[model samples]
Target: MAGLLDIAPLTEKVRVGGATVEVSGVSAGGIVAMIARFPEFRMLMTGKDVDVASLVSMGGDAVAAIIAAGVGFPGDEAQEAAAARLPLEAQADILAAIIKVTLPNGIGPFLEKLTALLAVKGGAEALAKVRATKSH
Candidate 1:
């Protein structure tokens, strides 16, 4: 019954601050907890443009919290503190790794296509024209 629906959590091994750590894909519960603790996280789920500046302003504490939650250690102050101590590059890598596991389809292809499209001359204008045509 329930066991039939139980799938193992997706996990990845990542190097963080000279240590190899296993990071699990964020679960439904983890998403809920993140939304509860950090309302800004909801923007990502909703496909809204997240304010990067605002998130960065939240500083290391927020980054630590995100890492802890993604690592399946939500509400663990000790774990969060440890994550905060890691170098910024390591933190970014861990976050990227977590996102990779969490998103089944992965965003790399989409981003690459988007970047290519945006690189084209008048791409924004063409997109706007298409949108305008659709609205008419």
Candidate 2:
């Protein structure tokens, strides 16, 4: 998870099911949307001290890596079974943790589609910790 946060090696791969997927960079706008709602995204635009276009162009592989890391289980069957065995809340917790560790700012409001269940279960604290951590 920590490794996923490092955006340097743009070609890194993570195991997902039986095949390997490359973790590519994501647009900076995408990154902002990932951690916060559009209404609140201005913080990301200004707070990060980054060039909007450059940050957007920064890490295409990073997004893939974050998702791959979120679904950490290997093997298609195993990943499916793992997801099935856990309650949606549990899955969200796992997913949120993965995103939090993978992204410098933590999971964005855009991810409410995925982490809505997690937000109900102390998502604030989880996000706080992720925010506290420094990303490379």
Candidate 3:
């Protein structure tokens, strides 16, 4: 008989550059690790207005880490490096796809809020403050 632990993880394919990459929902533990390692990630999961600049400040390393984690290749430097090579827009798309699988309600609402936030004042500076505040 199959058990709960025996079930295969749910996966989705997303395009990055010119390739379709398969990504899975990150595990609870993986999410926790991300939050711990990059506090800015907590803001993203909040489903509130996220500071894009703050996320960007975390830089390519953080982006790569998130991609690697979602792709079920956590700690694989080659995977991370590959992800780092993708354009920022492609990275965002991939992140959204990962969130689709990770969150029960999907990333639709979150992206909407983010879009609205981007239109507001403070932009990158606000995000910088957010990242700074979370670091301490």
Q: Which prediction has the highest lDDT against the true structure? A: 3
lDDT of 3 by residue, 36-79 (tens): 88766776654444333545567788888888988998778899
The local distance difference test score of each candidate is: 0.69, 0.41, 0.73
Please give the clash total of every predicted structure, in order.
0, 14, 0
TM-score result, candidate 3: 0.63
TM-score of each: 0.65, 0.27, 0.63
Residue pairs whose backbone atoms clash in candidate 1: none
Off by more than 4 A, model 3: 46-58, 106-136
Model 1 lDDT tens row, 19-126: 798889677688778777875565454433333344445578777887898788987999999989987778877887777787656544533454468658647565
lDDT head-to-head 1 vs 2, winner? 1
TM-score order of candidates, top first:
1, 3, 2
